[model samples]
Target: MAGDASNRDLPPVDVAVIGSGIAGLFLALRCFRAGLSVAIITKKSLSTSSTNWAQGGIAGVLDVDNQAALEAHVQDTIASGGGLCDEQVVRSVVYEAASRIKDLVDQGVQFDLSAEGIYDLTREGGHSEHRILHSRDRTGAEIERALTEGAADEYESGLRIFEDWMVLDLVRRDLQRPEKGVAGLWCLAPDGKVYTLASRCVVLASGGAGMLHLATTNPPVSTGDGVAMAHRVGADISDMEFIQFHPTALAIDSQHPFLITEAMRGHGAILLTRSEYKEWKHTDGFPSDFSYMNRYSTKGSLDTRDVVARATDTELKKSGDSHVLLVTEHLDVQEIREEFPTIANKLAEYGIDLG
Candidate 1:
């Protein structure tokens, strides 16, 4: 059926959480576990989250004994932040990474492990250690699945999940009050009807506005809805200028673009200039020259996201090309296929071989 709320009289809840991504779902689970009645309002299906589209794994230092690795994680984060990072936030995240990772596992999300049965951590751009734990290339999807299943188990126990329902705005306690307290939200159901579901507390977990770009890896719902709602209700939002752009995407003109994970680069893939790609496209393997990225940093392909993206932009402008290339030709084909089945299959569908 369509809008389930529109079909019946809505009930008041202890908490109304807007959005159904990882953040929203996780918060809802916690609140529900605490015996609070909860309702999750999502604009589309629960799966249409940027969290689901994320290809790389969660970054965390699972080893408590590795003090050096933990400090390196913090340094790597600050270094990648390009001096704009808050030292406190970097320290907090680096230190708490192990617990947060354990939390995910406790919630039934399984990250990839090596054949030795330990977590198969991988390094990505801006990382000094192999702290990125992924479920192959579709780490986000696996996370979404686990979290959604976690919610499903609680559904009958007063956890309400409303998919295909859009949150229009936050209802304030008193418009004239000095401190505007949140009462609930105005939701737009699939039947084109608006309904007010009152709550003791309202949480906005709506995601970012990456789709504001002409081309982005963000989903359609990432149009700054949560920010706009909070802003309209007099909430102060900061650090919005910080938008992380994935440096590489499959750039076939006639096809829709998809992200080419930096994980590829982390695992010895190289970025080639347009001419270089065309010149060596058919070659079985390429030289270990570290051509394009070395021009930006000594780390070459393993450079930070901003550096690599800037390097790609510079290469494009200098060569008058539309896009640069992510070359995997030099890598082991079977290993590439096994390690990145998601990406390998996707590229294969486009008449392209990842290696």
Candidate 2:
């Protein structure tokens, strides 16, 4: 099922894209639009990717009316990136966030919006303001749906999509004349066959290496394959220690760490020590029982992800507990249901009533 088309007299493709996640699909679509012959190779079905499991909305600068909000978000991101982020890249990504979001909308991606015609942006940890555009807690799924549809259209237009093909190794040939550079890859197909794929350009957008950690929010397939492959190919890797940890993954029976969006905290959910809540309830008067996150940061619960996660870890360690309570007393249960219907329903499976 996998072989160098050159061996079989098939037409050569202009580009070969590995992986069918958001990055790969979007790039393939762009290349197809540019009139280049393209092919996407995936190890499993195209739908199996880390992007599909994301519950948090993509962060973007959508509202010009909230310039401060935008600036704060940029600052928070930079801080969390821990000096590893290229300033230019960060700025470019931040500034272009709105435009990229618009591009997705133009491509038929529907994000949730408010009654006021504004994009319903939510705040996550490390964000200064509510700027995450979501679709009822399934933002990734919605975006993936749109991207996959667009990719299918490209496939119909003659772009090749080889599904269920596992890539083994890149087949690079040394130049005899010393002028021609490296060759291409030897990919493995599902049927236990190997094929050589020679291309002038090969793009690897395979995603992160969350599999090294015993406890990670990444999908099973997120085994740092791209990073490992790049390392084997002699690409200089940096900041291997820096990893982003979301604080509110559901602790009950989650096969993978099911992330609870920080938007819940942004909307006034409080992370509490069970002892604090219990002690306050048992006392004569409820003495301001709430432990607001300002004790951790000026931004309170809206502090950057690192801050929130560190605080959570420290609090849990001090309390000798595995999990802390997320109190949503200030938020209306009906509004929570309306805004996060999927999460509301998912929590019901564990007998945790969001109502």
Query: Which structure among the candidates has the greatest TM-score?
Result: 1
Q: Which tens-of-lDDT digit does each residue in 1-355 have in candidate 1? A: 1334634447889999898889999899999999899899899987779889888788988887889888889888888898999999999988998987787889999898899999988889988777799999999999999998988888867688888889989888998762767888898887778888889988989999887888887788898999998888888779988888788888876333788888888888888886776666556446436367776898888888889888888888898988777877778999878889889888889898878
The lowest-lDDT stretch of 10 consecutive residues in candidate 1 is 1-10
Runs in model 1 deviating more than 4 A are 1-9, 254-256, 277-290
Q: Give Cα distance to truth, residue 239, candidate 1, Å.
A: 1.0
- Model 2 misses residue 236 by how many Å? 1.4
Model 1 clash pairs?
none
lDDT of each: 0.84, 0.74
Put down candidate 2 lDDT per residue, 7-126, tens digits, no spaces.
522345777888888888888888989988887888888877888877768888876567776677667778867676787778788888888888788878898888998787787766
TM-score against native, each model: 0.94, 0.89
Q: What RMSD, rounded to one decimal, does every model reach?
A: 2.3, 3.3
Cα lDDT over the full model 1: 0.84
